[model samples]
Target chain A: MTDESRPGVGPVSLATVAAQAGVSIATVSRIVNGETRRASAETVERVRQAIKAVGYHPNQLGRALRNRESRLVAMLAANLDNPVMATIAASTEAALRQAGYVMILCDTHDRPDLQDDYLNAMRSQVVQGYVMVASQPSPGLRDFVERGAPMVFVSRRSPFGECSFVGPDNIAAGSAAADYLLDRSIEEPAVVYPSRESSTTRERVKGFCDRVIARGIPADRIRRADGPGISHLEIGYAAAQHFSAPHAWPRGAMCISDQVAYGVHRLARESGVQIPHDCEIVGIDGSPLNAWLAPWLTSVEIPHPEFGPSIVELLVSLWGGEPPREHLMPHRLAAALER
Target chain B: MTDESRPGVGPVSLATVAAQAGVSIATVSRIVNGETRRASAETVERVRQAIKAVGYHPNQLGRALRNRESRLVAMLAANLDNPVMATIAASTEAALRQAGYVMILCDTHDRPDLQDDYLNAMRSQVVQGYVMVASQPSPGLRDFVERGAPMVFVSRRSPFGECSFVGPDNIAAGSAAADYLLDRSIEEPAVVYPSRESSTTRERVKGFCDRVIARGIPADRIRRADGPGISHLEIGYAAAQHFSAPHAWPRGAMCISDQVAYGVHRLARESGVQIPHDCEIVGIDGSPLNAWLAPWLTSVEIPHPEFGPSIVELLVSLWGGEPPREHLMPHRLAAALER
Candidate 1:
């Protein structure tokens, strides 16, 4: 097949176009790069002809180097193993691609030093914009902005005033969980999650608390548990054990995540507690896996697929020199298993 | 504090170290780079003094440039949203880090072009090795290996030779699922998953089939379905509807993944099918989330945390000039809800 029509491998580069046209590299570059003001019509036409003949594709990185606008967006994430973050990454990539931007991914693993390294690397690479999902931002991030680079936060809002943030409306998600439990006629519900220190967990808890207060549920009716980490099963087992202990258990529960809820469900089943009938449960971050349980879990759908658009919008705004802002997408309250 | 000790800042680069030492950049670089075969002990001592004074932490990229070994492993996954693949990524990163290697991640979104782009980028960046959990090597990957880059495949074996692979013994996992169902005294059990194109899926099916054949269960007794893609809920809903149909469904089933098993559980509950007593379900990929679901899924636990170390070992072996081979780690069959 001709190189022009090759499936995976593309055409030759701009240098080949210059060679084919018997012209200076500068002339060919100027013509192809649309610096028509500097190029003669005949020269431009010759360069175009050469480009067509050699099937030349301009180097995106080289072009970006000259313009200082790479049309490349960098996304820094703490963990891709989290389905929520992965969905956000996928969505953001699609949205950015649609806007004629390429994406480069970096994983910080929640380490401050690594985040600093990535910020500098993104700067040196001259990516047009950045999206950071990790909660902690290193000093280098501030330095990068001071040195002139635009960035947006997703899933984590930066304390600094210069960066925009996009994520789910955690408070609404939490409140919705409370509403679902209350509507199910359950009186008191415990809350379980990995850490209350995180913005997501805090917001979720705040909403749940506000709703519980609004309903005039006694303060002593609520319980809270800090899960070990993302290992949801352990959290569930522990929480279940705590809840099933004689009269200490709350009548209902809201897990900070679906994974944790699964753990609770397992522990409850093992403990011989009936679900929904004895104690109702709700989870956040509606995962696809939750549906496979014998009793369908009631959950708050975080709109993971749409997270990309929200992140891309923030990045575009930053690229255009807009002030930092925050955006929270709506939540979805899923139905629970029918008795 | 010295900039090196700056909290939330990154490690000081070689440039800073050279500047702090007040020596020629080359001299400091030579010393730090262990080019000491020719350098005098005094010169090395001076460089070391400067490094200590500045608290110089070497840039990993620069170190790689000098040594021709990045010690930065790259993992290219098909879909980060898939919980199974996410576990693999997490496990692999943890393993590589323990071995003093940082990990770079890429999600190819199951596209050949995207896969090729990531492979090419990883190769150009001079990543120390590759751990791929995706199917089908892109042209860039094949070309890269032809030019000599160490690689290890996880989950999927490549058509090309000269690469190491590490994954579950699918035959064993599948057979175990079948044997477990039979152990429960179920006459017939159905197998469920989303796609047939996956190599892992094929292996799982083969293993399950082999066991069933040995048990004298007719081939037609194994019913298969597209469990769910990114939506296990849909799979659960579908399984529920299928099994709840007027005609009787199988008394037991084996799901391809934990996510799928989750759906089967839901289906059974919605259909008023009692697990183990009326129907039983089992799945692969021991995601911690399985613990919270009612009836607690019976699953095969692939060693997720050790996955990374195993892959790194394979890469190191290849780097040491080992020939193409396949390695399987032992796994556990855990009964979270039922024995």
Candidate 2:
């Protein structure tokens, strides 16, 4: 792209101005972004003229160069398509903005390499800190933490426990989903779960299984189906196709997420199965987008009203060299919210 | 945030390394990131030891500083919550990455000032180029365009046509929506449109009205509803409430977006109105997320399979200083797509 097209790339450097003015790039930068005290009046005029002629731009980089700080925080999200994650990112950005810190967003799409790249790039750029919503774990992130990089994790924790985390109580959310199914007299239930590569899903499934076994339900009775290949829809379809059979489908199902629920519902309709009547479905994360659809995706919502602000606060604490803390937000089922 | 919490901000400058090593920061920087030929072996060792002692982190900034360039492209989107926008963003990011550039995302939340802030910040950070989906027009964007900052407009044209754009032909989409409604034998068709701040909405409304008038339908017969307090549901709820007043409701309504159609469907259902049988609705930008819901929110499907790649190519052309080209991607109604 033309120099103009590349706005994110560094603009014409002070060196260009210096070359035109017969001065130094350092001289030009000092005169442009910082105090022009070191340069003589004649030299300053020459540098200014050269800068104007070269179309040189001096921005935050000048200030950052002098102070050696960018005062910027970035949030590495796994995917922006997920409304729940999007909400968290928005709130975090807003909270950071209000606190006079600019937020840079990078979505990794669950690729560990991409996650590492963003982390490395941001570090190279001298971003102040980061808040990560680890859709998937990245060893690169762990390296940063090991190197004493300040970070706050959300939705997923650092596998090594070297960082602070503020996230939902998945165990509670899973238990609520289980209790709802048991109360509905669903004797045989199935769990449509994504890969256990995700800690959140693992915790949720564990909580659910513990609750079910405690209620005297045999572990063998509860069917576990691999929900989706990626935990969005197609995988849910696969899981639904596997679990749903004539007179053999589970009476109730706990989905990894509402997205999985949507897929299950679509698959069931295609198969001519009735929801609630034949099989009831409950999922986690009652996303706002679900409100657009009929028969609201009954979900257990993890209360995260303070998620954004709390994470920001946690980052601040980390900056102050505080020990890493695991903060769990509460959760509630949709029915409980109404009551 | 503390000094350590902010890894992105300038971490341990050459000055610190110099102070520890009893040398100049510039000398330290040159030896550490640049050439070390000027510095003696002992001196370089002292600088290195100091750097390690001070916890100085040398990252990507060192490379960027020397070259004054970073291959980064940014997409300024209005909202990530909308799956349509998210899809576009994901595609664009993937395309950019494929072309050996990193994509930085900034969601404007449909606010002009925030958009401006991101633009300014990106500029300060020396980003190479930008692809804008103008949520709202602000002089700041126009100023950048006039200054000839490489920009590519998506979904909207630059108010001051100094840049290239890649988007759908909204006029034809609107005409198609009108023709479909007319073919259904609806006479009293009303247009549920948001404020004409968006050129996309303006073009769609104009085409619909022009087509209706050409079809011998009285221009006055087709009513228009105020469609936004915000583009998605709340205003749609308001429009639905206004339209469904006993005998006043329009027999057919052309909504500005599928989101608006969804809101109308919800409001109608609450009022016990049968869809298609009593009221037929059509909207624009058939989002993939809409498929999850029952009774599909029929819309004009703008063929954007190449949106991400096409726009990336357009930006590449702009970077090459090619003339600004207005690229109109094709579109078809959802009904037409099925056929």
Best by TM-score: 2
- Lowest-scoring 10 consecutive residues by lDDT in candidate 2 chain B? B1-10
DockQ of 2: 0.40
TM-score of chain B of each: 0.83, 0.81
Q: Could you give candidate 2's per-residue lDDT for residues A52-84 as a string of tens digits?
A: 676566666656766776767888888776767
lDDT of 1 by residue, A70-181 (tens): 5657788887766677778778877876786656666677777878866655544445677888557478776554544567788767755556778888888899999988
**Over the stretch B1-339, how does candidate 1's per-residue lDDT look in tens digits?**
353333123345567777766777887778776788777787788789877665455555444444544555778888777777777887776676667665666777777788887665554455567777865657766755564457788888874665688988988999999998888777768887765367777888889888987998888877766644545555655655666562476777788777666666666666667665666678888876564443357888787757777788888887777786788877788885664
Best by DockQ: 2
What is the lDDT, from 0 to 100, of the residue A287 in candidate 1? 70
lDDT of 2 by residue, B66-178 (tens): 57666767788887666667778778877887887777777788888998888877887767788887556886786577677778898888877656888888898889899
List A-chain TM-scores for all predictions: 0.84, 0.82
Per-residue lDDT value at B216 in model 2: 91
TM-scores vs. true structure, each candidate: 0.76, 0.85
Q: Provide per-model DockQ scores.
A: 0.20, 0.40
